[model samples]
Target chain A: MSEHIRIVLVNTTHPGNIGGVARAMKNMGLSDLCLVSPKLFPHPDADARASGATDVLESAQVVASIDEALADCELVFGTSARERHIPWPLVDPRELAAIAAPLKGKAKVAIMFGREDRGLTNEELQRCHHHVHIPAVESFSSLNIAAAVQVISYELRMAELADQAGEKPQWGTQWDIELAEQRELELMFEHLERTLVKIDFLDPDNPRQLMPRLRRLLQRAVPDKVEVNVLRGILKAVERKMESAEKNGNDHV
Target chain B: MSEHIRIVLVNTTHPGNIGGVARAMKNMGLSDLCLVSPKLFPHPDADARASGATDVLESAQVVASIDEALADCELVFGTSARERHIPWPLVDPRELAAIAAPLKGKAKVAIMFGREDRGLTNEELQRCHHHVHIPAVESFSSLNIAAAVQVISYELRMAELADQAGEKPQWGTQWDIELAEQRELELMFEHLERTLVKIDFLDPDNPRQLMPRLRRLLQRAVPDKVEVNVLRGILKAVERKMESAEKNGNDHV
Candidate 1:
């Protein structure tokens, strides 16, 4: 069950932090680790910090980019430190475990931890379907990278343990339809955006908050595979009608 | 509220781990820190690990024994990595938070972490009202001291946040708008059905399960009033686009 969960560290500066993360992940029963452009790896400091969990570090995957790290992941969660002006779907670590645990057998979940200093970039965060924020003190909000990993890993273990003990809280009725993966949702959004622009509903020049607002709303909905197909069908229909109208010289659009 | 909660480290061997614990506590809004006969105090390694949370270390109270460390506390929880032969009240970190957070203002709580090599002794365990275990992987159960502190501190913060929310909120900030009312939802559904039919995505003659499936998805989202309005506005835009397409007599629909 733990194998399906991947912990990705992005541009980690401190080798020791990477090692600490490995130990934390091993302690919580997780094994998959992906490093994206880490400043230092396989360093003595990291090995020393990893302690007995050196095996985790030894088996860690090193990749050049976040896209490469998350290529096959079905669900992607980015850890965010600051609140953005435009709201995004946000969940606490416990809530995150609740949402991710039930999909253990069906999905590959990736939790991304940013650099030790500044954390994930705005562009990097936009790639995620949801943002996870550790409810730390606002005054001293930034937690050590390894410490952040520990807290999240701990939550996941607790949730998994509860499941083993037959105490898992059922989150909504068992999902009848398979949930849409990251790539599938991305394609549907692209199609939807094209249709909205063609229909003159969305000004391509000044899209502003329209796309983000819609993303937040739909992401919160967490559409299933079938639902994504349905939404795409609507977009296709709109596109066909708009193309036909343009061919007929309707000009109003 | 956080000041009432104290974190105690007993016979800590590494000054670096002590500093790590301080940063973890400060990140979680905890301040009171007591050290029970730690091997080193005011070490450079400790300050370095504490990051910007050196204030937590500077103000830390160092004592000679557990009795002195937990002196005026009303409740004490000892972190135990190993299971004891004799059964005692054992609570996981989440359960610990649930039990302790309510005692704010009424009781001073002290949570103790034992040595890095071996957790609290049986005698020390007896001092605690309850034994708090982190529930790590049983095979590699021993977590780094600072990591353990981080997990426990995070749960405490989560519980306190939930408390301040009055009800167990979905964590983070509260929703800004009221949820869509039943009447508003029904109206939006009607509008949505009309748009789907006009776009030829949903056949009015034989809608089958399309409307029901979409309803289930959106209902699961539990959108707020503003979200409902945004959705309705999208539907209106789609309808207007379709109306123009139809009026142009280019209706391949």
Candidate 2:
């Protein structure tokens, strides 16, 4: 259970927070730590703040992109503090632990903590299986990044200690159905957007939120591999129809 | 149940933690806050950290000591991260909320959090009827003060939301024996102090906190109107006995 959990920090600016997060992870008896394009690491501030938990800092894997950080993780969760214009499939920390707990022996679980101020970019967020929110005072919900790690780490420890893998809600992500990987999903999304543009249904210049909304809806739906292929097939058909229409119009000209 | 719960932080040194606590408190819809001897209140750090929870901080009752913080509270629970030598009746966060849930409307409940480094003092620990521990990783269990508040507040909110108080562990107050006003309680405290002085049992000049200790004891009991009247009657009798003894001493002199 300990080794299966991957705690990822994305684009973290503060070296102290990286150290703080390492300390938090070690406290919870978790070892695997990953960083994606962090601005400062291997710095004295991180070493100083890590205090006695320098081992975690030394072994942390620093990656160039989120995809690389989360490539092998079967179940990925991102911590989201603020609600977007469109909602994603969100769970509180406790529920997330319950969901992740069951995947202990079966899957590698990665929990992502975003940057201090801007949080995870929309592209990074859509890569996650679930968006976990630590409930806070709504009006003033400015939770520190490392502190967020602490709370989630605490929950993960509790769930692991409780060994509640069997009771997690059935999210339909069972053994029979394979989930579409982020790369494939991103390709499908690009195809869908292009098809929408070619059909004149979506304005590229004034594309307010057509793609992100679709992404959100599809992300929540968490389409399986088969479903992703079905969606891609539908988009290809629409693209061909537009191509044929354009050719007939050219003939008219 | 929400109205009955008061979140108290004692001797908090960091304004950011205070703001964080305020935000956490607001997230759980538990607004009643009492700060005992905070080092740096009205600081911008707290306001900045509080995000939008300034109202919770603004309406927060800033008190001089834990006694005044719990002055009107009928049930008090202090959070302790580690085990103490003297075992107080302890409950995890959820159980504490369950115990406090039933006391709603009948008694005001206060949950105390100590300073970051040295949790609640033994003397402060003694003031509470029960001790609450938020289960955490023991190796690195130094949870930031606000996060601890967030976890407990979350539990309190869940218990309240389960809405068990309305049906379970009935406190029998059901609109009977109106609680004495805080003003009346203060007046009673004054009278009791004056009478104790007249009896030569207490020295006003060298007061060793006899009145405050008594106030702490009585506040936790949260006596209702009838009980208050009975205590007042007893105090009046003691006052009369002191007067008669003084008169006899005068005659003998």
Candidate 3:
């Protein structure tokens, strides 16, 4: 159950925090750690903080970008410390656990924690199917990066245990269709944006939050690979229709 | 509800751990903290590690003993990393929160964490009415004390929020009778043990697991103040009867 899920830390500033995250993940039975553009790694501070979980740190995959970290993941969750204006499907850690638990062996899940100072950027958050916020006290809401990971990882373990004990209802829908991977979703988003521009429904120059809103809508639906392909095919057909109208000098319609 | 609960760390080795625990507690909306004979307190390491929770560290109580830390608490939960031979009422962190959350405002609760090297001693474990064990992976079960605290405190906050949202059933049984406080339970145990020895039922020199077994039984019942009083009354009555029989030269009978 733990093997299918990965912890992704993006632009982490502190090496010690990376070590702490490794320890937290290992403690919660999770071993897959991916560091995306971490400021420091393979540092002594991280090794010291990792304690007995140096193996996790040693085996961690350090990637240059969030896209590379999450490209192959079927499900992605972005951790947010503060609320964003974008109305994405925001869930607490426990809720995320419930949603993610039954996906074990069926999907590759990636949970992303951002930098020490600023959390995941709006652009990074858009890549996630859901945003997870740890329910910390609002006044002193910011938790240590490792502590936040610990809380989420702990919930995942608890949910996994509950699932193993047959206490939790199977949350995953019995979809014979394979879910679209992150890279597939990215491609579909590109196609969507291009089609929206060609249809004159979206102003490419002044695209404020339209793309993000659309992303949220599509991400919430969690389209399968075939669904994504179908959506792209439709976008291509719309482009073809627009091109024919332009060639016939009837683009006004 | 969070106010009524205090986190107690027993003989923690590192000052940094103390700070980390404070941050974890504050993040989870818990303020009360009591450290029982930590190796170092008010150290720079602790303050550095506390992040923004310096207030919690500053206001933390430095007690002399676990008994002192738990003296006023109506309920005590000791975190154990390994299983003990004693058949006590053991619960996972979520289960502990389910049982502890409803006691908010009604009871003062103490959750104890032990040293970094070794967890709560058997003698210290006996002091707790119940034991909480985080379900970490058995092979690498030991968690950083702060991570452990974070997991437990997170559950507590989750349970409290769940209770507030009316999603959880009222778990606290409406007891008109006040529950036995830690000191009251301790006194009752002393009286029971003395009475047993007086009645030749328990030998003080070779008292193996008798007291711990009895403690487990009584702790599981979670007797109220009146119940503890009644039990002490019975022990007193038996002692009085034995004294009179001894005075009348019929001690054997």
- Which candidate should be chosen as best, given lDDT against the real structure? 1
CAPRI-style quality class for the chain A–B interface of candidate 3: incorrect
Winner on TM-score between 2 and 3 is 3
- What docking grade does candidate 2 earn? incorrect
lDDT (tens digit, per residue) of candidate 3 on A109-187: 9999988888988899889888888888889888899999988988899889878876432333356578789999999
Per-residue lDDT tens digits for candidate 1, residues A157-222, read 888877776543234556677778777888888888887787677898898777776776777777
Taking all chains together, each candidate's TM-score versus the true structure is 0.87, 0.64, 0.80
Q: Looking at model 1 chain A, which ten-residue stretch has the lowest summed lDDT?
A: A166-175
B214: Cα error in model 3, Å: 65
- Give the runs in model 3 whose Cα sits over 4 Å from its true position: A166-173, A248-253, B166-253
Scored against the native two-chain complex, candidate 2 gets a DockQ of 0.06
Model 1 lDDT tens row, B1-253: 4778999999999999999999999999999999999998989999999999999999999999999988799999999888798999999998999999889889999999999988889999999999999898889998999999999888888889887775543424455667789999999999999887776788888889999988987887777788889888788887787667667654443
The per-residue C-alpha lDDT of model 2 at residue A212 equals: 58
Clashes of each: 0, 1, 0
CAPRI grade, predicted model 1: medium
